[model samples]
Target: MNDARPPLPAPPRPVRRAAAALALAAVAGSAQATDVFRLEGFGAVSRSMGGVATAQDVGPAGMMTNPATLSLLQAGHTLMGGLDLVTTDIEVQDQATGARVSSGHHGSNRGPYVAPELAYAQRVGAWTFGVGAFAQGGLGTEYGSSSFLSRATGGLDTGLDNSSRLLVLNIPLAASFKVNEALTVGAGIDAMWQGLNLNLLLGADQVGSLIGASRVSGALLPVLGGLPDLRGAHFSLTRNSPLASGINAWGHAERIGMTYQLRPDTRLGAAFTTRSHMADMEGRATLTAVDGVAGQIPLNGNLKIRDFQMPAVLNLGVSHTVSERLQVAADLSRVFWSRVMKDIKVGFVSDGGGDLNILLPQDYKDQNVLAVGAAYQWDARWTWRGGFRIADQALRGSTLFAVIPATPRKHLSAGFGYAVSPAASVDLAWSHAFREHLDNTSLPNTSAPIGVNHAQDNATIAFTWRF
Candidate 1:
């Protein structure tokens, strides 16, 4: 009988395996992984792009888009890691009152993130194996009554609060084989651990307070015409907020790449990474709310978002040397975010009656990137580097998540490196993103007009230490 599982297909060829490896490695490498205001071009060059070298010569960020990177590590065992700090300015408005207030809780030193990365590479014969750990992306906004949003909800509403963190720890086991004196091919498998925590708040409203005062039937009623139990207005906030969040994810990635020396002083490289089809995203969303007149609700819900594919990416880079003292590079890349944010069917479960299953909008889009950078060796002991990149906005003018409010942006940046010696180097860089403001959630009343404001901005500084 053909019950032998159809004789498992032959293991992929070494070349095929290599390509699969690089693709797998780029699983979470997308524009969404970048800082709030920074765009990629989506994975285009920014400060992180400078950490790894690609044949595109766009500096180091290219490595993030592919796994063929181990081939460029000088030699021996090298370690790289860095930290990034970003901030954003946000606002919410009342369309009814034309009152726009700054969400005091808008931006903080702790957003887009303090992404920490670690990568180590070792050369074995003609092959290179590397491993790394970093946070791809994770963000959520919280708007309290401090802003017009609070005024709109009643005390009735605490505010809008949602937050999550996704960390992708990658262990790349790869081997690079030299195809020729001028070309090298590499492939690897990336084991990833994706962790996330989500918090949400559904709310409730009281009729007594809504209308203020009224006359019931033939008698005068106290405050707003609302009855004691009239028009049960209850907005059960899906408290995505957790008392103590605890969740994690584990997955695999495959990648492949090729790099060739075009000239004695120049090199070109390309990488393809596989996307991740989520088998299942299971987690829990803790909830809290005020029921009717007065009551604090405590709830815990188990959530397994569902299986969804991450997205695939293509990366091409080039690096050229003008002289012994100057080196220049550029890279072009594409991320199928459109696929990543694909509309999907989602389900939510809680102890009692929580979000059963819902179809949330997959409101993301595809993106492209362009990065250019250079490094100058100032002596045997000193080296300097700098670069710039552009990223695109995923949200358009109308979107449901408008309450969270996001605006597309433009970022400008510059940085340099200081080599304490041949064994130690410190790198520092800065970037800023500016977005216009318009409040879209505020559906207007007679006194207000609905509008969307994404007037947001960002400033970032990153520090890297390499040995």
Candidate 2:
């Protein structure tokens, strides 16, 4: 019945501090969410139904999902806007050292993240026109510059901050034609924008290794040894394009969708979104030289992120009314992730004044998502909804990192809506994914055992006005 903690083995002052610094930095700069950072749902009603909206015309979000559904909206002008509040958690443990650390509590600069959306649709003659702007998805994690990752390494004074953010936005203009009472077709043009900000610092130990192995050779090593070991080096080796000015790229894509009314209470829909061809992300990069090396090293005067593209997606859905006041729907989606993320490359200038590049192999696979949702009219002004969704992981073990944890495989959700007027209404929804646990020991280096547990919560509310 004894409950006590075991003391960790104490390494040298430098080793312990260095180990702690590297661990924190890696965790802080971890990749964004696993679902490839794609948001599950856009509007409150759709989110409440596990993002199953392909055939259901709940709001103006059709421009982002199934543009064909635009023609199905009641003849009028409709505006919809909403925001999502997300909470994420990441925890890591080093196997070689038995050291464990968390990204800090939920609210510790990591909690309550926000995403916004807006859509407007209008009917003119037989055509329905719509425009929408929204963050397709994003993932980010920030750790204080003075936290363990920095304190153990050298603190904020060294100008090494552990943080990363990846965001993608989409603006689409859509039009749908109602060919007949039974069918409608639509298409859209999307202006896609992507941006990234990453900062990773190598502590003294890694710096010393890099200097000894890459910079100095037999004769140079002996001479450099007389100066100083890189044990005191505080090198911000991977700080690239500040988010304000970093890798910002723009691209274009197309989407087509169709909706068919099979019966009085039944509908079927399909949609296809083309992959985007974006320009390479470029930015200036600088590195603090190995301590006592005299000056900073222009390692990457111009860093180029090569061949970054978004995947194409296909969706099939069905909606039906099984009872007088109840409707049910399901959607199946295919995300061609493997086609776009075979590998990630970073090209930079080497200290030797030559062009060099690093290729991080991804070898991702295609993934699928299946969602089923139901809505029940509880009263003249109230409706209740619930949904479930399951997805396949696209990333393989070789590509998984502590910073980029696995995406969740299961999601459970619930939500409700109220009609304030015939032309206006509001909806609210919430979803939760259980924690996903991962253990990685196969990384090339005899690195420590790295374990990460990730989980998330999403809450959304949207308003719709019909004019």
The total number of steric clashes, by the backbone 3 Å criterion, in model 2 comes to: 3
Report the alpha-carbon TM-score of model 2 versus the true structure.
0.79
Provide C-alpha RMSD values for all models, in order: 13.4, 14.7
Backbone clashes for every candidate come to 73, 3
**Candidate 1 structure quality by residue, lDDT tens digits, 121-204:** 666777766666544444435453344443223434444443233334445556667667788887777676554443333222
What TM-score, computed on C-alpha atoms, does each candidate reach? 0.69, 0.79
Name the top TM-score candidate: 2
> Model-by-model lDDT, in order?
0.46, 0.67
Please give the lDDT score at residue 380 for candidate 2. 56
Q: In model 2, where do residues sit more than 4 Å from their true spots?
A: 1-34, 104-111, 143-160, 201-245, 288-300, 349-354, 444-446
Q: Name model 1 segments beyond 4 Å from true.
A: 1-53, 56-63, 94-112, 150-155, 158-171, 201-247, 287-299, 344-346, 353-355, 400-409, 436-467
